[model samples]
Every structure is written in C-alpha cells, then in structure tokens.
Target: MKKNQSIYLFVVLLSGIVFTACNKLIGIGAPKNQLVTESVFKDTISIEAAVLGMYSKLANYNPGTDVGTATSLFNGLSADEGYYFPGTFYDDFKNNALTPTLYYIDGYWSNLYNVVYTANSIMEGAGAAALPEGYKNRVMAEAKFVRAVCYFYLVNEYGEVPLVLTTSVSESNVQPRDNVGKVYDQIEKDLTEAQAMLPSDLRYYGGNRTRATTWAAGALLARVYLFRGKWSQAGAAASTVIGNPGLFSMQPDAAKVFLANSQEGIMQFVNAIPSSWMATNLGASAAAVTPNFVLSDSLYAAFETGDARKANWVGIKVYGGKNYPYPAKYRYINGVGAVEHAQLLRMAEQYLIRAEARTQLGQFTDAAADLDVVRKRAGLGNTTANDKPTLIAAIEHECRTEFFCEWGHRWLDLKRWPGIANPAVTRADEVLGKEKGTLWQSTDMLYPVPQPARNVNVNLTQNAGYTN
Candidate 1:
C-alpha cells in the first residue's frame, strides 16, 4: 500500500489523534481552522477532496480499517469457522479470556469511530458548501451511507455503544451509550435517505468501483432489516436489487466472486495498492507456505462430498507432516498486480437475506426458490425443505457454507439465530457445546467495550461478561 500518500490525504479528516482514549482525556478536538474552512468549502474540488479522504481512510488496510482482517480473524477463532495458528494475538478470543484491554479489540473500537467522525464532518459541512446542487446531494448521501455502515458493525459487535452523530468535541467525548434499538433507528434513517439520493447505477471515480450507489445502499438495508427481524422490509429490499440485472447478478462460478470488478460485486473495497491481507493471512502461496489460519475440521466436514465450493475455495498443504487446509477464495496472496479487491457487500448475501425473510413471513415455497439460486450455483440440486421450519434450517446451512471465512458472517449468524427470546436453544449454545465442550453464555455474543473508551467516558459501561 502507498502508506505515505494515504496517510497524508486523510490526516486532515482525522482532525486529532484518532478518537483515542488519551485524546478524549486531553479534551482535544479538530480545531475550527482545520475543519472544512470557508475557503475549502467554497470550491467544489476541495469539497470532493475532503469526501474522498474518508474513502481513503477506509481503504487503508491498517490495524483496524479492514474489518475482514484482524477483526474477522479473531471472530472466526472465537466461533467454529476456523483455527488461528499464529501467536497469542488470537488467544484471548479463542480461549474466552477476552479483556477490555486487548489492543486489537481496542483498536477496532477507536478506528471505526474515527471513520464515523469523518462522516459526521462531511454531513455537518456539506450543506453549506458552494457546490452544484447534484454534486452536493451525492456527497451528503455517500457520507450518510458510510456512517450507517460503521454503526451497523459497531452495534452488532458491541450491543449498546455511543452514538456520535456530530463532530463537536464535547459531544464526541461525553456521549453515553445508546440502546441498541435506538442505534438501529438512526442507521435506518440514514440508509433510507441515502437510497433516495445516490445514483441508481454503479458509481466510478478514476475508473475504480469505490463509491456508493443506491443499489449498494439498498443491499445493505436488506441486511440490516434481516438482522432486526423486519421480514417484509428485508424481502422487499433484496427483491429490488435482484430485479436490477443491469447492476447485479449471481456469478455462475462461485470462485470468481472475489475477483476484482466481478459482476456480483454490489459494493467492494477497491484495492488501488497491493494489499490482499485476506490471501496472505489465510492461504498458502509462494510468498508464504504456512498460512496464519487453517480451516476447522467441523467446517471442512460440513461440505458435501462433491461440493464445488469445497474444491475451489480451499487449498490443502502438508506442514510438519500434518495436513493444513487454508482459505483460497482470495487467490492473490502476494498482492502483486492487485488482482483481488476486498469483497465487502455482494449479491449472494442478498439472496440469503431474502430467503430468510420470506421464510419468516410464511412464504415457504418462494423462500425455497431463493435458496435454490445459491444452492444450484454451488453444484447442488434444489433443496427438499418443504416446510417453513425445515426451510429455515436449510437457509441457515447455506449461509454457513456460502459466507464462511469471508467476513464474520458465520459468527454473526450464530448470534442472530434462536433470537433473543429463545436463549436456551441458541445456536452458539448448541454448537459450542459440541465443538469445545463448553456452554455458550449470553454475554459471549458481544465483545466487551474497550477499556480506553470507558476510561475517557465514565458513563460507558462494559458488556456483561468483562471487567473494565
């Protein structure tokens, strides 16, 4: 990655040392002059520069920027998705000794909110910028979409969190954790507005698929609704994106979905530089023979004997006279030529979301059809799940295989299933019991609020299980 260039571009957006615990204690905020100064807002080019700065911050594959990197690795180790062979970086997650002081966990919390701060800066400044009407509206919409996505991951990971919507110094440091339901309400509001303002087609800047569009916003809304149990809304959103064949389609080959500019990419993190951490850390390549993570026995055994995904998505190697299977979805481990881009939001997930939503709404037969789209693509025949109860189980199985090791999809699925009301039969409770011989506690679902955040703001309470 062009670390120096990216850091220089985003330094203005950062305003202060990242939203760090130390910074908050010192009462530091972006100085008024450093924010979108009147001179900067008066020019359209400068305004665009500021917004692109937020994109640069996200695309940087540093400690906390790439959610699919360290964050997903830790989550997969904690769940049944995979096994980490690296150092004690993963021990806290794997062995359930997670404390608030874990550096990576703390970095994830602060880095995400740093992105949130940039988004809020744009939202606060764009309204007064002297730009063309169309340009101003599009910039505002993109910022809102970015902010909503950040909060989506935060709420899912840390149940209740501080909802920082403004860029004010005092408000940023003093805000108390909002209820999870309340946080989702704000996410819904932002995405709904973004859907109307962004363009219907895929957006491009300098010939790269980095900007958000209305379709991207819709696909994400579908996922958010699915998580929140809004069945009809989720189904409708997914169906709308599915209908847009010009903008999206399922890649007939499951192996090609992670390739750059693939047809199935609804939204992706365009890699302008060579930094495919997914491949380097998870696969065996000439650049590195021993990968950091290996596929879990349970995950490998779950595949059907002739499943195409098993053949195409995993690579087997012998190290120290033991077989190690690693994720091969990302083929460019060396990151030379930047052949692979990070797959964040894609079309396949929309189908699974719709299938689950339709099942909840009692549209059993239609739900089966949506499941078949993904199933057939994976070299499997139509499912035989004829009833709602049976079909829900079938859909869950498809998600586990389709999205394993890509993001934290499997871990999040285990948390969302069985719903909050049915804690006794939670999927984690059952699966963890068999895999690790231990019972899953309810609080294990959420990561503890990082101690640094709590140290800065006394009102922030840690999640149920951990001590600050």
Candidate 2:
C-alpha cells in the first residue's frame, strides 16, 4: 500500500466519477463512492492528470450536443450571424424564443458548471498537497484560469449565475445567483492571479499551445476589461500580449489562422480526434450537400470587396440553385490526419481588444493602427475611420467579420454595444428588432436560467421574459 500507488488507484476511480458527472447538472446529489480530493492530489502524476482532465472534459465535443459547440451554434443562431436550417431543437435559439425547458439550454448550463466544479476541486486539492511550491502554484493557476473562462461565459449567457467556488455539493446547491458585476469581479481576480503564476513561455506545454500561459491569461483579461468598459486597463492588458512579437504574431495568411499550433494561437484545444467538431457540423465536404448552418445575408455582405477572409474563411455551397455560405474556418469535416484544432484564444483577438479599448480612450490613431493589422492581413486597406464614433463602428465591424460563427463574439458584442439613439438600449435591441421584427425583446439579451436547474435549486431565479 505505497503512497503513490494508492494515489494512482484513487485517480482511476475519480476518472469514472468525473466522466459520469460531466453529463449531468451539478445540482444533482454527488454520486456514492466518490474518492476524497486530498487523497488524489498526494502525488505529482495524479495532480497533472487532474488538471489535464479539465481540458479533456471541455474539449469532448459531441457534434451539436456539448458546450464546445453550443456557444458558436446557439449564439450564432440567436444573433445576426447565421441561420439554423434544421428547425429542430435549435429553432428556439434561431428565433430568439428560447425557453427554460429546452434540453440544450440545460445541457450548456450543466456542462459549464461541470468544468467549474472540476477546477474548484483541483485548486482545493493542490493547495493543501505536500507538493513542490512552484509546481503547486502552476497547477492552481491553471485551474483558476479554466474557472474564470467558465464563469465569463456563464455570466454573459445567463446574466447572473451562482458563483460556485467550492467542490462541496451542499454549498453549491443552495447558493443564490450573484450579481453580474460581482461575477465579473471574480473573473478579473482569477485571471489577474493566473497571469502572475503562469509561465511566460508559450512552449511550456512543449509548444503545443494547448495549455494556458501568461499570454493566454492576459488575452482573456484584456477581453474582460474591454467588456467591463475599463478602457485603459484593457489596452494595457492587450498590449502585454501584442507587444511580445517573438511569442505571438498575426498569421500573415488568414487561411492558416485556425491551423493546429499556428503562430497566432494563444490557447487552443487539441481535438481528441484528428478533425474538429466545427468542421464536421458546419462544413459540408461536398457542394451537393447542404450545411446545417448558413451565414446570414447581412454577415455575408459585411465583407468588403476582395477581402481575403471572405474568400478563404467562408465556404459557398450551391444547392437547389441558391448559394449558402457556411463557416470554413476548420476546413476538415472528417478526421483526416489532424489538420485543425479548436481555437479558444488567438493573437487576432488581442489586436481587436486593444483597438476597441484605445478607441474608447480616444486614442483614435493608435486604434486604427491596431485595426489595420487585422484588415491588412485580410487584404483590405487601412480603415477610413478617423474619429471616436467612426473608429468604434469600424472596430465592431472588424470583430464581426473576423470572429463570426467562432465563439459567439458577435452575439455578445451586440448585447454589450449601446444603441445609436439611446445609450440605455443595447445594439441587440435595435439590430435584432429590425431583423426579427417583433420577436426580439430587450429582456431576451440574457437567456433564461434552465428550468431544470431552477427545479433542483429553488434559490435560482429565472431571467426576465421567461417564466419559471
């Protein structure tokens, strides 16, 4: 009964529990025979496995079912980015008529919390383990980064969510929703600590870009600050990553940006299989076949004439004599030797974040310079925007074209940006109202908290416009 051998045994048992629990919501009671975290974190190998498990769970994409695809798919449909053709379960999202009882809504909430709970377990276990200090800190930092990302999405999609920081089910089950500002504060705190604790070298994970680094933390932090309207802080955070030319640079070729381990990637998830889930779902291998998702006419028209991204990143399928454009970012629909990986964070986003932050701070010239870097890569000339208002509009347009159907960037942006007539109204209200024609409501900006989640925990409240 050696210590390392016992810990190894615990890791094996824990794997089963984690895999099983990942499929359901956290509000359900903990399964019987779960091993204690303290026992599992006794050794270095087990601790590494625990951290690796977090990525594994998040990266496990099951076509259209899991959280990995939910953001891009559901959010794309909800916003002006794309349309869902199947008219099945996802129609609710496409029409901005999401209900609390939808299975995908429940699945998304539960899956994200599953990752958060795993991160909490790792941080709690690694803190008290008799491991080396540096190694322990790195592991905990990684967990914090993962947790911060999960919470970021949760807050954006659900408005206010229970800030679950502990692995204890009893504590999580009865927890009430925290305010959006408070949840964002926690995200900022986690990412700030992660930036300090993570390694500066991107090659820490053997040059794979699959693991989190200081640059990844900074990239995400910059985005957080931009969303919060902390313009100066956002610019500074984005500059940290953008300034490091050796570690990161924009891929000159727009087509290669989503390739596995590209120079542009700050953080990506290595697909368990050789192909990407996005490719299988969005990309139709043959022109004769129709894509499940197609770009909206507005998004297709947003591209400037002769923009390379429109040519390279968008695929046109000619079916029934009508052209349908779908996302061609991943390109490989089937597993054919690992050509693409799921990208989480990349250098292009940092540039856009800085561009927006600088525009907000009235540094219009510098902001245009940042915006042009992306535009130039897309084979378009520098932006014609010269003032604050124009620069803001230009930056938003660039983000929409560059990140459409990737990670719900367009959906979230529409919600955050202010409407033209009234600062109190969001762009989502103005834009979606015209597009949806009476289906769009301001309260629909945040999705309903899944009814299943509220059923399990009476403390949970539904978002406005959706009945409990």
Candidate 3:
C-alpha cells in the first residue's frame, strides 16, 4: 500500500541514488504513472502513489539484499542468542569483533538513510508543489513520522550520521557524522514535528509497525529519554502514553499475539516467502539457525511450570536420551510461503516500562502492581516488593520472562544500568563462566561501525572501539 501520497509517487519515481537531488527528481520527467512535479499537486492519485512507495521501502529494505535489517536482527536477538548469534561458531559478541559481512548492519544503515531521502523528496515536493491541502498534510505527516523513525534508527545504530534534510542529492551529498548529541537533537525535532502532524489513530500509520503515530511517537520519545538518561522526561513521556485511557491495554492473551492476522502487533516486517529475501536452501537454512541458536540451558531452566509462554519454544522431540528445546518464534510459519509477521511491540512492553518508571520513582507498591499485571499474564504469580532490592529483582525477572523471545531486550536491559554488572556476572557464572556479558565500560556501547562502510566513506569515522 502507499505510505502516503508523495512518497509512493517518489518511490514510483526514484528507486535509488540516481535521483537523490531535487533537480534530478523533477528533472527526470514524470513516469507514465505519475504527474510531473510541476503539476502533481493537481493529481491526488499520483501523490498517493508516491507516499505508498515509502511504506513499501520498509517491507522492501532487506538484509538479504545487502540492505540493512540490523534493527530487525538486533531486536530479534534473544537472551540465549546473545551468546550464540554474533559469532562464526557461537561466541560471546563483546569479546570478539563483528565482521563486515554482517549485512544487516550495512543494510539497515543504508535503508534508514534511503528512507530519509524518500521522505525528504515527499516533504520537499509537497511543500514546493501545489497538492490538495488535505492530501498534502496527510502524506507529509506520514513522511515526517517515517523520517523521524529513520533518524531514531540511525542514532541508535551509529551515534551520528549526516543529517540530510533535502531531496536535493548532490556531490556535496557527502556528509560527515554529527556528534551523538546533535543527532539526538535532530531526532527530537523530527519526532516532535511528527507527533504534531500525524493522526491520533493507529490506522493512519498504515504499515505494520513501520508507521509512527502520536502514541508511538510518545513511546519512542520515552525510549530516547531513557537512553539519554533523562529520567523525569522519560517518565513524563511514558506516563502520558501509559495512562492514555482507552488507548492501550495488555493483550487479552499475550500468547496469541502472533496468530497470522494478529491484532496485538504494533509492527513487523514479515511477508510471504518466495516473495523476496527468503534465506536460501529453506530446510537447511532453518536447521542452521536451530543448531547454533536455542534457548540457553539457564533460561530454559528458568521457565516455571505452568508458564504458558514456555510453550512458544519448540522442545526437542527426542535426541538420544535427552530432550532439547528451541524457541519456535518463527516456527509456526508452517508453510514455506507462509508470511510470519514479525512482532515489534505490543501492550506487554508498556507495562514493563510503567513498572520500571514506578520502581525508579520509588513507588514500590505501585511498581509491584505494574509488574504483577504483566507477570499475571505470563502465567507467573503476582510479585510483592517487600524491599528495594526485592522490587528491582522482581522487575528484572518479570522483563526476562515477558520479553523472552521477541528480541534481546533482556541483554540490552543489562547493558543499560550500571553498578549491577559484577554481581550479574557472578549470577551467570554457572552458564557463562567468569566473563559474563557486561556493559562494564562506556566504550563497550554502540557497536563499532562495521569496517566495510568505514573503509569506503572517507567522511565517515569509526566509533571509538573499532578499526578498519
């Protein structure tokens, strides 16, 4: 479907960098499906086509195509795969370096910026042209939201990037990275604008989670604040959305949030296979993923009996005398062509954040209520926070279980907080030995901008830790 009017039109117009410049945009002359820039404002259909193309970009930005899906891949890492997913043969990611072949990183970075360009074309064209007022505003709002999201992804991945705001691509297009601080500033600018311009409802977002709206913007702002350590702002942003009546509530059954036509999903980039970007050699591809990746024995054993979430994983049918279990998150796709919609967010995370914010505010009892709401859904009994440490532990435990398979939220949670490291290392010593995955130092953050891109973009510099 069209992302918006102008973007879909531009997508129909521009496929890659050849037309990044605003001049080249209208310069190429309009395609048969489009109205030329000089006259598109009079044609709503052409405008509609351009906007739809922006949404299609998300569905089309594939890691397999050497476009970035790093966000997709990173968000998919589980507590178990943090140990296995990064290496040649299942090694801890921190102790080793990631290779340039990590196409997801490259692709995601490229795709996000491409989104920036597509979005800019829509924004600039509409602003400079004479599209219908209603159609122009709607399409521009969608474009801004997507552009805001692109910046968020970039800032999260590479602390800084060239902040290009025009559809005009030129030899001058080569831009150096902005400091992380400046990037965050640009992100806030876009999100604030996006929040104002986007509609209040979910339908306007259009694509899975690809679209951003008022609440999504709020939620993302909360996340940004949290990451930047703006606790009060984070609390305020999260609370606004968390307390928005009739807006969001936990899934009636979190277990069924993934059914083919599931309603609970905020967004996912899933599509029917053989459609495009299928990992080749299907069965063997499936097997390769399983052998190297499975629930860590520690996490597997962590599941309490009667926990319905445990059922999501595919337990080994039989292996010699032992039985093994692998997460079946993607398993039920069943058919080779079945499109398993990827889940990005649901009601579950908001509860965890409210619980966390409450805990951080020292409202232990309230925090406990927040935690219990989620804990109750996962088949875990309600938790009581008898003391400070107890409340924190309870919150951590709730998150581990709540976000188990969707993404490696657990690993990132550990990475965020400080002074909690060594003790956690001691805790994981049994499964991971002396070197637990620790965010012991600041330098450890923001993965090295992979070498391949570094070597080529002379204006680009690597993050502090990596070398070409």
Using TM-score as the measure, which candidate wins? 2
Measured with C-alpha atoms, the lDDT of residue 398 in candidate 3 is: 70
Which of the numbered candidates is closest to the native, going by highest lDDT?
Answer: 2
Ranking by TM-score: 2, 1, 3
Worst 10 residues of 1 by lDDT: 19-28
Per-prediction TM-score to the true structure, in the order listed: 0.91, 0.94, 0.76
Per-candidate local distance difference test:
0.75, 0.84, 0.55
lDDT of 3 at 109: 63
lDDT of 3: 0.55
Candidate 2 error regions (>4 Å): 1-14, 19-26, 61-63, 273-275
Q: Local error of candidate 2 at 157, Å?
A: 0.1
Q: Count the backbone clashes (under 3 Å) in each candidate.
A: 0, 0, 25
User: Comparing 1 and 3 by lDDT, which wins?
Assistant: 1
TM-score quality measure for candidate 1 = 0.91
Residue pairs in steric clash, candidate 2?
Answer: none
Which is the better candidate, 2 or 3, if ranked by TM-score? 2
Off by over 4 Å in 3: 1-42, 63-69, 72-95, 99-104, 171-173, 202-210, 244-247, 260-263, 268-292, 313-322, 332-340, 386-388, 405-408, 421-444
Tens digit per residue, CA lDDT, model 3, 40-64 = 4335665565666665665555434
lDDT of 1 by residue, 1-468 (tens): 685566456555443323232223212233333354465455665567667766655655353335556556767777887777655557677765678988877767766776787777777677877778888898899999998988998898889988888777666666788999999999999999999998887544543456788888999899999999999999999999899858679988877877787888887776643236676666657556576788889898888777778888888877789988877877674445337777778888999999999899999999999999998889999999988778978987898788888768888888788833355677776676567665356578798888877776777887898766
